[model samples]
Target: MTTGSTYTLQEINALSHDDFVQALSPLFEGPPWIVAETWSSRPFRSLDYLHASLCAVMYAAPLEQQVALIRSHPDLVGRAALAGTLSPSSTHEQSAAGLDRLSDEEIAAFSRYNQAYRERFGFPFVICARENKKESILAGFEQRLHNSPGQEIMLALGEVAKICLLRLRDLIRS
Candidate 1:
């Protein structure tokens, strides 16, 4: 087990079975099972391996599970953010992109677009918020709306992977 502001790669690679899951569970927004599943493939040689292992678990998951994972993520500037109840990571990422400072018109636009995207895809719009600005997120929502459901599913999962990688990088020491 390791506990600190950051843990070295070696330290993480050496964690006990349960400790490993506890350390990495927050990397994904959805299933807590992802980390436990990933922990079985221990001795990750690098951060990339750690990320790839997680993605593999998600990819190997059932279709319903993958969709559940997608659905697990809150909408950008959605109810959680509005109620000041977003997870710490989400709050920070969203605030960094000015999501927390939206104007009334902007909030309305986001709310409307989020609803439309959900109606079309059956899941919330997802983007790596830390890697994007407010404008790009809105633009992406519009663009992705045109994609087929299959394409959107793949893209959304890929976005989730990117989010997990960024969060994992934060958790692991450089």
Candidate 2:
């Protein structure tokens, strides 16, 4: 697989569909479908352009595809196995890492909220979680659970896009 930041424009352009997706695996934490759609078209002039195009594709993708992207994300409650897997350049951005510092009561409450959210939405709770704390995330979960399925799905997708954008920015900047 292509590793590090040494890809040439021609190399990127020459990648097959599967190769491209593999190279971008670090970017999409959730489902393969999301990475497939996002990386199908390559040959970006710069990272900014790439990020913009990704956002456009995400917004234009089908609902199921969007959900796949959101579902690809790692559970918010743990450290990402790979470096740079999550955005915001801090361990605190990881849901699990941040929650690890919380009291048992807080963790229990978050678990309950997560279960309730999944029961209602048919998927795990989704959040950008860059600078948010455990309390804020749980509050968000509570508030978002009240939204209709259609609305929540859209909101989840938007959060996924934001997470992708942040990660992409960091990828290019590094």
Candidate 3:
């Protein structure tokens, strides 16, 4: 479906499990498992319930799986972004945050932060780019660097939830 296409809650509730997974697959970065798991909670009462169910499945997953989800995301303004290899949703999200318009110095700063965050936390730093501009994003990179690994995991997942919520808001009609 087109990024601007939205599904009515009734229509979403009626989709087959496989179709449901396919429809919502882009809501998460990597895995369809989260949407797959949420299918069991179908006939959702509202968009809020659907979003909560999806996030519940993800948050309940084992730590390794959670980390793997975070790992699947590309670094902000990193190689995939520069190479024009990001998923369309990601490309739009990054571009919205002005990451696509960075200067050489800004690119270097992002590279340094991306490397440092990966080295420290074993995963790329994640944030809801739609909620930030270049300055706030850079500030976030600096501030979040001080977070402990476990804390960063929770924080990153929270950011993922925010991203998903915005995506859901864009795609779901109550």
Candidates' lDDT values, in order? Answer: 0.89, 0.65, 0.91
State the weakest 10-residue window (summed lDDT) of model 2.
Answer: 81-90
Identify the runs in model 1 with alpha carbons over 4 angstroms from their true place: 1-4
* lDDT digits (tens) for residues 20-91 of candidate 3: 988898999997889999998988998888889999999999999999999988899999999999998899
TM-score: model 2 vs. ground truth? 0.73
TM-scores of all predicted structures: 0.95, 0.73, 0.96
Candidate that would win on TM-score = 3
Task: Evaluate residue 40 in candidate 2 and report its C-alpha lDDT on the 0 to 100 scale.
Answer: 57
Candidate achieving the largest lDDT: 3
Total backbone clashes of model 1? 0
lDDT of 2 at 162: 69
By TM-score rank, best first, the candidates go 3, 1, 2
Per-residue C-alpha lDDT of model 2 across residues 16-38, encoded as one tens digit per residue: 88987765555555555555776
Model 2 C-alpha RMSD vs. true structure (Å) is 4.8
Which is the winner by lDDT between candidate 1 and candidate 2? 1
